[model samples]
Target: MTYGYIGSMRTRSGRRDDVVAILLSAAGSLRELGCRSYVVGLAADDPDTIVVTEVWESKEHHDASLRSPGAKEAIAAAMPMLTGEFTSRETTVVGGLGV
Candidate 1:
């Protein structure tokens, strides 16, 4: 089954741009990680909050990608822009409910 990950982050005050830049760089690494889809968006009601969604071929593929050098570097680079602890959840894709 396909694997998906969603991460929620909040940028430090006055650091939204920095956070977005970091995420963009992180997206580049994610692209090399067997990622089928990757997207980052800002929360509509909260400018400081960002949401990242990723789809991978499988859980194993996502795990392997986590250990990649690019992933490591991207994560390290993003750390400083974070305001609060980031949260993540993983799930399996079942039948889609109409969006």
Candidate 2:
């Protein structure tokens, strides 16, 4: 089954742009690891909020991708700008626009 991850991340004040750039720059690496899509979006009214949506080939693929060197590096690169906690949801893709 396909796997999906949707999450909201809050960056330090004025740091959302930095976080988005890091995610965008790392997209190619994630795609190579079986990530079908990794999209980053900015919140319309919250400058510090970022929305992340991801689709992976499978749960295993997504988990394994996090273990890849590239993923670890990407996480580390974005860590500094992150603030507070993140909210995430995991789902099984039954049918959807991108599925």
Candidate 3:
């Protein structure tokens, strides 16, 4: 089954776009590692938060992505800009516009 992950990150003031940039830059690497979709966007009312929506082949694929080369690099690059602040929701994708 496809696994979906939505991660919300609140960066230290003025760093939301910075982290989004890092994620975008690392997108290709994650795509190569079985990430079906990696969508990055901002909350309409909150400029400090970045919302990331992802789809993976499975929950294991999603978990394994954390260890993927691109993910490792992205995490390292975004770590400093991040306040370690975030929220998330995981779900089993039964059906969707895109899997």
Candidate 4:
């Protein structure tokens, strides 16, 4: 079974783009660590919100990715721009298009 994770974060005003860039900076590294899919989305109605949907080979892979140097750097760069509000869910991916 694959591991799926969806996370939504609220960025400080005018900081969404910067935070999004920071997150994307590590996308390549994540792929090398077993990420199957990684998508970043912005809410059209809420400019400050960022939604990240990811599928990993397993829960262990997902967890390990977070500990990677690139991931750690991205988190450090984006944290200050965030509003401390977040929503996240973990799931077992069964089947899906492009997944």
User: Which one wins on lDDT?
Assistant: 4
lDDT string, candidate 4, 1-99, tens digits = 899999999999999999988888788778789999999999888989999999999999999988988888889889999999999999999998988
In candidate 2, how many Å is residue 78 off? Answer: 1.2
The CA lDDT of each predicted structure is 0.80, 0.87, 0.86, 0.92
For model 4, the run of ten residues with the poorest summed lDDT: 23-32
At residue 82, candidate 3 shows an lDDT of 82
Q: List the pairs of residues colliding in candidate 2.
A: none
Off by over 4 Å in 3: none
Tens-digit lDDT string for candidate 2 (1-99): 889999999999888888888888878777778888788999898889999999999989999988888778889988988986799999987776765
Could you tell which candidate, 2 or 4, scores higher by lDDT?
A: 4
Ranking by TM-score: 4, 3, 2, 1
Query: How does candidate 1 score on lDDT?
Result: 0.80
What TM-score does each of the candidates earn? 0.83, 0.91, 0.91, 0.96
lDDT of 3 at 87: 96
Please say which candidate is ahead in TM-score: 1 or 4.
Answer: 4
User: Please, what are the lDDT tens digits per residue for candidate 1 over residues 1-99?
Assistant: 888889899888888878788778767656566787788888899888899887888899889987888777777887788877688999896645421
Q: Which ten residues in a row have the lowest lDDT in candidate 3?
A: 26-35
User: How much lDDT does candidate 3 score?
Assistant: 0.86
